[model samples]
Target: MAYLKERHLFPGGNTSKGFYSFYKYILSQEDGNRILCMKGSPGSGKSYFMKKIGAHFAAKGYTIEYHHCSSDNNSLDAVVIKELKLAILDGTAPHMVDPIHPGAVDEVLNMGEALDMDALFLNKKEIMEVQKKISKTFERAYRYFAAAKDIHDDWSSLNAESISTDKISTVTESLKEEIFHTQKSGYGADRHLFATAFTPNGIVTFAEDLVFGFENKFILNGGPGFGKTEIFKKIGSTAQRKGYFVEYMHDPLIPERIEHLLIPELSTCVLTTNEISQTSFTGKVYNIEDFCKADVIAANKEEVAYCSKIFYDLIEKGLSLITDAHTIHDELETFYISAMNFDVANDIFDKVVKKFEKFE
Candidate 1:
């Protein structure tokens, strides 16, 4: 059986503002049917376990949303089966989530329960030392990121002044018409996630896959501070007010700002090209720079170049620090991996899948 697959990031971690999370979006009984919070140390097979369960249901034609980790794109932070209204998430620190309706709507799946106590006990000191390094390394990376954001903001202020506010609506008029041609009035909902992340390895994005097969697309391409995200917000809010569900994929570096919008009901999407999103969009490609006076940007090119160099350099420094930190984290994981029994974990994985097999 063939099924639909989607990917996103919940808590996007970066240097600009440290870590920004959308974990509260994990709705339980009132929102969804069930939520499974997996408790375990790093490299304890939580991601793999979740994948196994997702695969089982997807094979039966269920639509699955795989939430990838910001720091590690290869790893998953959560697995959501929309058809079942069920989700499984990594319940660890940084973005820790506890059950709002334990037992009733939420359940804890603890992998540590099957750990070899003697093995972990013998390696406790090593784990402590590695943990210290990871924390400190992240701190250093954040500093670099903060500096880069400050510089980036300064550079963007120059371009922001030249934008034609009135033309914004004109540019988006076609998109507005396309999205609301057959609209219903009432209240709708919105969910926030990330389509890209500033990972230790580098910028990892799933933009192409997320927007794949959509009938219509409105894409923006230009430099920062050109009102790209604001365009997304305007269309997104209007869509919501019209009783349409919208999935907002935010900027990983600036999590508060959205970079893309997906309205599944309409089979339409809107987005902007950015440093983080490596997606090459097809459809109406609107150049955001068109709204800005070319002469003004040309005059400020030197300063823009200066700021751009430093901003990206600082970003590179941050990524380097994060990479180093993860290298140390890998060492820390070795201890946990050595102490865990794969056979027991696999058994637990099977039981978790079995519970969902009976779901309507």
Candidate 2:
């Protein structure tokens, strides 16, 4: 990867050396995949560069999906919540980046109507005046989402116009209460156990403990506040230290990195929560089918194979995988193992499983 430091990935590609560095670094990865963010003033070639890169990737037979945020559509959060609701309602998870995630297309279509209602009945100045009002209204819209889960619990009593705003608030509060109120649903007892540890100074600096290599694929499971997020950040920092390119996706939308990394047949990895699985149809929420299906599938294949090897034994013997949180998260675990030699793989595998038996 250091070999890329002096080379440029683009000529006349853009107006900045950052773009050149980005191109080369992304190319240095095993799959030469990356997520690149192009942010600049409106006329500073952001769009032009995106188009150029998109086309370049397309010419190489890599898939591309693009979405531009603007005033008319639902905001990113609204999209995530809306699609999450739809998935639960329909019992089919949608990709995080779906149009449905942004509330029905009707909502987007209705925006024109809503804006017209604001405009035709009011002056241009009035519309501008309500801009803040609209923003404030959305802040409360998330409340409606919280309440919506049980809006029809008493279906026979339902009437859209008959229900008062206060009633909505009451119902929303009831639903919100369930998140913290534990119940013996068998889920709590059967829940997966995961462990995580971090130094107070933080692993963001990449100074946390390092496993020389990894040996299997694993899932990192823990409830909120148990330090799962910190573990993820540490993995990113560590991978970067190993001289491998890294891309982080914290967004609900299809990551922009995929566009840049896989263009012209780029291979890339996407990391996020399992909740992401709910929104992506064709395994993606937004219509970014290309990212989900592109050749060189995203996942830890070696660890997956290794895990599959011992899975049945563990199930029959009632054993578990014992290792640090980072060694088990399916994504990082595979990469760590892949970077190791054969002897290291065997030792780590045995150590991880032996410790897993004593994790309780």
Candidate 3:
């Protein structure tokens, strides 16, 4: 069966203060998969090359996971062919990845070798200027995020009394028991994904895909700062201990918050969301919002609304800054594109694909 799924490794905007990467988890030892890390500058055709590889395997009935770039949703960061136990990813700045088991299970593909370095060096001054502009715009974006985080923290603190940690724990314990029945020996690997991403359509999520292979699913409905992450952590940890590979999908706005957990061994999933309606869920609906104290919500209603407005407004500003950074990045790409030899790059990529055909 050919299956395709897309997920983000990092979120766009100020959600993460520094570079956030899931490369370690993707290239973990447990999977024993070969990683072909591509090294190249922007517009060197890394993304295009990976996509061609993905399409080739997908046509041969392999399940493919497309890891998308957070900054430019149109581009891909990596592609995985799970059936072949293989992956090829972009190994560059902000998400640079190196071979853990070089000459064994990992190797590097230098796409930059196909570039005319002499041509690129001629435009060094212009390229450096654009790079500096990109850095400045990204800094502005993070500042907006820092400010938004402050407002969100205040809102959480104000509503702390309304949320019951004990209740959250109890619910989690019950879920653990219900799912696992009896704990198993050995630990399974953990994988990370971003359910929500900053795309051209604004913030978007692939939440529905989380329940694809599961017979039983739980859709959690609640607001932020309500111990949702704690609940997900407990369940995911429990499943890992019970020897089930778990895919943890995190929230884009709040990096610490896990929005979904897929335990493939048990064919089950637990997803948290406020935007998706319960009626649309294929499985059970768990409305954790009911646990909130109505009286506390009533008393803090005005402050909550004001804080929320401020947080969202700041987030919008941060996103706009990111958009500006991408604009500068696009201009920077022109120099690299001019230096790259597409004909040579395409030939190299085809050879890479032919090597994978041995697996068939």
Candidate 4:
């Protein structure tokens, strides 16, 4: 059976305000593989091109990973074929990717070339103004995230004293030994399933998709600063050392914190979140809340609730700004769409299909 997995490269979070790209990991030539980098502006059919390629491979019973855009979940950022060690990604702004191996292992497919340059230049002034507005909106969103992070940090600090180091060590060691019986040999790949994208609706997580084929699943439930990430990292590190391909899903807001780990070779998945309980998965849950100082949490219940509200409110404000940015972005895309030559783009797409046919 084909094993398909989905994930996000960049999350909709504070880190996105800077350069936080996982494309280098995806385009790594460690295995001497090839990558098709699609270079184009918005509405140039880049996402559609990736979707078509993914569908073509899925039809042939190959496992494909669809990397969705953090800003617009409906759009795709990349598609991966694990068996072939190949990937096709959107190489544009915010996450611009350049070929490390150039024509050898990496090549560029300039979809923007099919656009009418003269027509685009005709609306250059309006396009520039819209671009500026888009940037400003994103800046405002990041400012909101920064404020939210401050409140979150304060809340986490309040509970930091309640975390038991002894319990963390015990849990980490036990989980490590159980997950990785013996260190095999080589290292493995690490990946993220979400980006810094928080929409007005709320946060998005593809945890279920990542664990779809796993037979053994463990959900670790605990409060903030409870060492859940430490446990996940311990197991993931051991798994990587033991020669298992590991996908480490990081918390969008906290990149250093691991949210989930998937070792496909063993069909094992370990997630650290209480939200998994809401899912259909009937996995064994190991509650780490036992190690937390319940008395302290109970004492500061009101303070905790207040801080949580502040964090959520700031995040909501950020999401509102992002929504506005997307609105302007949509208008920006209209100009590009009008300037593009779909007929030529279709011909190029057909050629790309023929190239993939050779893979069969």
Instruction: Give the winner by lDDT.
Output: 1
Model 3: ten consecutive residues of lowest lDDT: 1-10
| Selected candidate, larger lDDT, 2 vs 3 | 3
- Give one digit per residue, the lDDT tens place, for model 1 in 1-360: 122464445445563889777776745457777888889998789888888877888888778878877777777888889888888988897778777789878988898976887988898898899999999998898889889888878887877877888887777776788668877778778888777777877877777778878888888888777888888888999899899988898887777778889988888889888755656788888887887788988888888889889888988898888889878988988998888899999889888877766666
Model 4 reaches what TM-score against the true structure? 0.91
Query: Against the true structure, candidate 4 has what lDDT?
Result: 0.73
Better of 1 and 4 by lDDT: 1
Q: Tell me the TM-score of each prediction against the true structure.
A: 0.95, 0.25, 0.91, 0.91
Q: Give per-candidate clash totals.
A: 0, 30, 0, 9
> Largest TM-score belongs to which candidate?
1
Query: Alpha-carbon error at 37 in model 1, in Å?
Result: 0.7
Clashing pairs in 4: 8-193, 10-195, 11-195, 11-196, 11-197, 12-195, 12-196, 12-197, 13-196
Each model's lDDT: 0.80, 0.23, 0.74, 0.73
TM-score order, best first, reads 1, 4, 3, 2
Give the poorly placed runs of model 2, Cα more than 4 Å off: 1-123, 141-218, 251-360
Show model 3 residue runs off by greater than 4 Å.
1-14, 199-201, 274-282
Clashes of 1: 0
Better of 1 and 2 by lDDT: 1
True-vs-predicted CA distance for residue 79, candidate 1, Å: 0.8
